[model samples]
Target: MAACVTQQNPDPSFTLSLSAVDGNLTLVQGEKKNITLHIERHGGFSEAVSLSLEKKGGGGLPSGVSYGFDPSVASGSNSTLSLEVSSGAPVGSYDLQIKGSASSKTQYAYLSLTVQEKPQPGSFSLTVNPSSRSLELPTSGSVTTTTEVGIVRNNFTDAVSLSLESSDGSALPAGISASFSPASSTADKSTLTLSVASTVQANTYSLRVKGTAGGTSKYAPFTLTLTAPPSPPPSGPANATLLRSYQWLQSSPEGDQPAVEAMFYRPRQFKSGVNIPDEEGHGSIDDAGAYQGWDVLTPPNGGKHGSVWQYSKPVFIRLTLNRDARLAVVWRADPSKVPNWLKNNWSEQGSVRIAGSDRRVFVKNFSAGQTVELGSVYDPGASISQNLETYWVLFGEKDGTPSPAPAQLGSPAAEPNKPCPQWVHDQYTTEVTMPNGSKRVLATWHPQVDPVYWCYFGHDHGSDPSLFKAGYKPAFGYIQDDLHTSGVLPEGHPGFKNYVWERDGYRWLFVHHFGTGAIGRVCRQFHSLQVAVANKSTGEIVADLHINTDFGPSTDNNTDLPLDATCPPEVPTPSQVANQSNGERKLHVYDGTQGSLNGYEPWRSDVPGNILGLNLGGLTFDTVNPITACKDPGCSSLMRIGTSTGETRLFAVATDPNGPALSIDASKAAATGEFYTDIYGKKLLSPSDPGAVRQYIKPGLRLEVRNERNTECFARDAFFMFYEGCALAADVPQAFMNIEGALSDKN
Candidate 1:
């Protein structure tokens, strides 16, 4: 027997033992409890000791009770044992064994756990002496309001803590704070004070006064009202009064005439008289004009027959002040009442001259209201009464066509000697016989004389003609080609043809066509031709056609058209090219191509996947597709226009692309801090800019495209057209052909 035992195995190399630091633990149902266990090593035992818990009876575990150890395998001197008792755990004492093993040797410790039913919580109620309180803050000082809070306890004596919070879970308004005399107290009552700083906004607030005792909480409603002090009176004279009115007499070729109609009114006064003259002389003076209020002063003619007296005359209203006073004048027009012709033809036409000064401040578009302060006028001693005159005038033609206004007394107009191109002076009128046997003037290269300049002609026709293709020969001139077939084929054919006509002592090219029903009833099926005029004798190009060829169906897309028929290579006029480097070149006109004349192009499509491509200043820009980028309601009516600066701007509606729709009264719109926003929802002008005035263009406003040279020369003679004529001045990058005509018949 191998020495038979050799003396009992030397005591195991090491011994592992376990003992519970806390032999007993009490846990309520659904509660978690922890116990500490002492894991000890004896006789040189050094290996990690595994720890576990088991019911003494050998059942998996007390029903609904789970156990875990901080260190399941313990190499330290102690371990933590956590036990979780579910709500459904058996309510009884459990004898558990904590086993610790090391190197296959095991040791055990005993633990006792008791699971008990949860105890009931004490109850309490909260109340306030007054449920609501109101306080007013001075303009520069804070205010305070107080309320008494009462706590009623039922089977509860523990201290109850008090806190205030917004009933809606939001933070208290700025500068507002709540405090209690005794923050946490067992007493039945406590004083609650709410302090508000002057900076606190005036409003009604709902607050909750919460009292918490352990896990039991109660709340009382507290209403807080804050009021702001009343505003002080304005510091200035009491009021203003109308002193007198007078008209200035001037002489015209037609004979002597009053420069303006002078009408007097008191505050809120309505006057009935022969204040306005009738254009057709069809109505009695009594039936001509009637005004209700003095707040808004309008042209005496009531905007009838497209005639505005102020356009031809200046009106002065004298005001007398008892003391020093500040005056403000505003210009407004009812959107619905504004004539469509005025809106379509004019950019800005109304203006007011500063009192006792020739300086005139132009008003915004009639549709867009404007306000200006006349500034404070000081009394020039008591002997002489304070008298001031407000001069008002309207610029533009009586027929609603844009024209230059006469220069004021002090400000001289632009130099009128700037001579126009020689060809412009030599051009003669060309007429064609119409079907009615009446001679229609087709090309009046030199029609009306410019109001400002003597040498410059006022009218010419060279621009996008898409809108007038169906009319009689355009104002310029054209040759018809009834021989061309009209139909839509793989190789497109022209439906209507127009050829170059002679003008400005040179053969001019002006080709525009509209598709007929036979070609395609769809507005998208159209053909156009791009043309340039060259001096027949010198082969020098007078106009260079620069338009996006991809805009529409061109000869390139239709093989039937002759490629060689296109305009020759551009050779800019010698003087015009030389002036460009000297910064003397003014306006440039890039003739629209046939494709650009098409009513429906890629940029105008409403399809979802199509991207927007804008042709601006001869350059193309790819912008976000309006169909997808437009998030505002009623986006379908949105329209975009390209600025000469190479930016594509948005309009509120397609029908009124020049300005925002006048949906609100002018006063109300200004009061609400509301203004127009571009397509990107950006404000066009910030009112905060010093001396900045906001202007808007009338919707459906027609644009008359004219070269800068003609506009500049004409503006020199008639100063008012300087602003109107140069509205599109920035669109020109170089001196090109002088084209003048409406961009669209409607909008």
Candidate 2:
């Protein structure tokens, strides 16, 4: 067996060799190209080899120019090499060396890449700061206003030439002309000067600014609202202030009677009626007896007694004691109390016995020592003998002896508890522990101003803009998204119950109350986190601004918690949309996508290839494709898009909590529970109104864009590649679950 045997050659120590199928490539900046890299295994080497690029020396690959291999590890012998150049990359030639190695043996190959200037598409774009601007020009002379314009481009960088002119069919006022500084340049920004002759009409003018670079050209719309100079202030002493007084109704009967415990504010000088003194100012009259239910003293025999007091001027007041002395009557002692008899209505008052209670006490004129006899003070009418006996003992006799008790009073009319207006509820009532201790109820009969406003405001950490940006949790609530989207709350659903408007600069919040369920369990509860303000000048409604406090976690027994001291940064980001305009705003929040319900992220495009392309350089997307990232419907109408780092990047839209994968739509107004920008400037919806949601999102509603929050973020070109529904399940993080309460099947 040894004579003819030819031993198999020993496996050679692997020697690796690398070569490129194509040794050279020519590409433009911001372009991506691929080359085939071949690995040769010699001397019977069969093990896999890993490949990587090597820097020649002194300098590395041009800034933002990168490469990678398809098969990162060479399995057999070949792999595809991918080279990419960023849009901002400088044009230059590069000599790159790639290396492949298996075992201890490595081989190298050379690649020559020629990078050329990126070609500009046939279109370029321009953006003007403050797309809508205003200027005041005097009637006698001339005036000048300036706006800055920026050139916008993608995958291209060249000197953009500029031309300014009046928009089609919208010429500038007759004498107005436009000019640009450095008419043509490669700079990103340019100043536009507008000069208006006194002869120009004072009216809004539409203007257009066009930019041309390479072979591409684009234009932007600019608005110039010209108005006459403001008029001088009145030269005389201001008009006498209207001494308006606000008297709260402390107690109201099922049927009409009179307000109990009336109080008044002393008149003071004021130039404008808008600002009212916050404190009680001063109380002039007292009506304590009316603090008790006024129905008991309804003048049994149809006698005028417990009636509303409408005081127009300073006057004498009188009080009458009932047979039992428990009932009292407050009426005007002087006829002068009537300012205008026909127009004067019953006046309400504050109770002096209770520190802060408002009562609807009777106010009417009665002659001094007037002996106004009445039958009885009870609904069924009291006995004459008993009434006389008690009356004699109390009024006739000046002694301290007490009189006999009168007959039991009849119950007031049905539905004794009528709901008060939200504003009234906030001003006169407070949350108090009920007898059963099941839930808190509004103490309607309380005697003090509701301190809820001050308490919540004290917890408003968003007072500082920076802290709000850094993610301060605010004590707020939102309507259910499902209800809002349907645009109509079901008939049996709870209505908006109570809210306070214009507190702390038009900020307000409200709650919804649903009656107990079959098992006597509380069924309905909701909260308004933020409110909207409307522009008085333009009649626009502004929503999407949050000005409030953050609340602590909710327990099974107590859904409402006290305000938290601080909002930690790690907590899920709350929903916050800046008010791009003046006034109150509205927002609808759901449990959040997968319970993380942060804001929306429109920058994370849903397009197939674009999903992963965001991390790579040199990728550009057509922004007009509604399915692409930047292509949300009507995005251009809301904002202008541009880039600064020479990269063809677009703006980021709103985001939701799940992740930055879906984009929010800014073009359409949000329905009841849908997320929305402050589409309507300063317009507000009545939380108490059943139809408020549908009315708020009516398609005919056209609110002016205010941009008060100074937000210019627009949808990136990549945002519109695909649409992600709000119902998409999100990856709920563990930390968020612990903070926002763990989710259950019902949740």
Candidate 3:
């Protein structure tokens, strides 16, 4: 049968073949080309076939190059093959294979592609003047810079289209925009304007300025450097100096008080160029044969005591040293050179006490050039940055024997005879030099001993410590004053007007003051305070309390009463009496609407049915209403009230478990309320002033109250105490219900 195999070959079934309509293809980078792909069917092959393009060598398509078929799946004979080469595609020859498959049968077509770089006309070249630019962006508003793009033409006439792009293929950064004047131009030069918004961040950027014409593109490298604007100048004075001088009364051996001595110590640097001439009975000669010692025992008629010595009209001297430095001062008080009156009543012996330490030193037989040295001006183990050295030289009878040598210079004084009480935790000692050069020592155990110290620590636990036992604590507290000013809206702003007083507008101003006098530490300690207002009826939080001040530390000190030596009887006394100088907050009372003249009208007092418009007179306290005094940290229950006039007061009231337990009794209001006393048992409010009242309630207590618009509001006024060894008690104190009407207010 094998020998008889003369059978002719039969036609194959379903044979598929593929071929390109065109021959080898050539394209420029970034160019797209399409060619027809013919699928030949043999022996009536009609089954659906899929088409795909792939590299013949088993590698990815050339970088940035891609290929696709118009009809990826084909039952027809013809299909279009589209090939695209990106501008960044590699310039090289590539071999690709077209694959076609159907019903487990496969066919292939070969393609040769050549990607070439776009041809350059060489007729024109692009050149940008100032290829690199640097600019400082402002904090607000926009800035613009310009550069000229020149086209060096060599027989090129077609208009050139100019454009810009990031060299790294990224979009321009936010806040940056660009424009080209004469966008498509035959002119030699075009202006390229780059605008930078304030919002743009500072950085360096690489960019390309492209000029395209006649299917050719020319690129010019450009660099953009942006820098942040310089910071604004400081608002306060620079290198301002402060000096304090002190005065002391001196008695003579004859019992005549005809002389007074003024003493102050400053850094030795300030002594340069200062000349104290030798005058009979006025100055003493030092070992160098110069009148280098301070004036001693001047007669009362010479000049008023305590007058700070200044090198210039307004310039004073001060020095700051580290805690480890020993503070010392030098002075020679020659009794023989005293004035005639002082000489007649004075003796050779003298007594003196250091200011902060109260360490006494005795002197005898003063010599012409004998310089006395007072030891360290601060106590041992003090943590102060600076010390105040004051010499109280008295010419009266000496009660102690003179030391063999003057007190050792720069040596720490002996421990004081009186030690701090054992119950005083974190018993620290600090020295304060007044604006008048008077020095005082403050200790936590006995802050009341120094007037300046008491102003900061006294009454810190509220008007009465017992009030804290009832579980009632202060929630929020602040001080406010009034400001009279005027301003007009600027052009392009809503409600623009010329010469309009701010007070005449629909909004009212809320001016809050913080820190005053020597209590500038208050500003430093409580730099920022958070406050919240809530709706008492539903216990819902409403608006947040906002004050328009930086709340930074204050530099105001005791400048008005420079020579006053008396300490205040209690807290808030001298501070309230002193001029208000510190931080201030000015806020406008308006609805949250922008650019509307009548925005604040809704909150005005003239508006009817507005809870904020209700007229609240002086607070009329109920004498019989008992209040609980908190004796421990965890007693529960507190009340607060805030008025439209910027006055806030805290209180604790008791009633049945439910039913409007804490609220202002409008029915019991009066034209003038009774005055309330402060923690020191001193009357702080006057009956005649019905606008507001003030009080400090408890330590570490926080209270919350509704805003001026709400009918119900509450607040707690408290101070924070910092004691190293004091820990909060675990047991809540028993409620004392007798202090029902005992409310505290702070204006």
Per-prediction count of colliding residue pairs?
5, 74, 29
Summarize candidate 2's per-residue lDDT along 1-747 as a digit string, tens digits.
Answer: 001111111123332223322444445567686777766553366778787875532246778789898898877667888888897887655656666666644455555565555545633456565455556677577888877786645545678887766777344557877788878877767888888887777566767777776676666666676655433323442211111111111112221111212121111111111111111111112123322212221111111112322111122122332222222232221222322321144243332221122222333232322423321122122221221100100021112111111211223211111222244333333353222233333322211111111011100111211111222122222333332344332212221122222212222222212111111011101122233333334434433332111221211111111111122232221122111211111111122132221122111111112111111111111111111111111111111111100111112222323333211123343343322221122233443333222122222332322111212222111101111111111211100000001111111
Q: Model 3: per-residue lDDT, tens digit, 475-558?
A: 222212221011111111100000100111111112112211111222121121212223334433222222222322211121
Residue 182 accuracy (lDDT) in model 2: 73
lDDT of each: 0.35, 0.32, 0.34
Clashes of 3: 29
Model 3 / residue 385 / CA error / Å: 42
**Candidate 1: tens digits of C-alpha lDDT, residues 308-369:** 12233222122222222222232222223223223333343233211111221223222111
Best by lDDT: 1
User: Which candidate leads the pack in TM-score?
Assistant: 2
Better of 1 and 3 by TM-score: 3
What's each prediction's TM-score? 0.18, 0.20, 0.19
- Rank list by lDDT: 1, 3, 2
What lDDT is obtained when candidate 1 is compared to the true structure? 0.35
True-structure RMSD, every candidate: 35.1, 39.0, 38.6
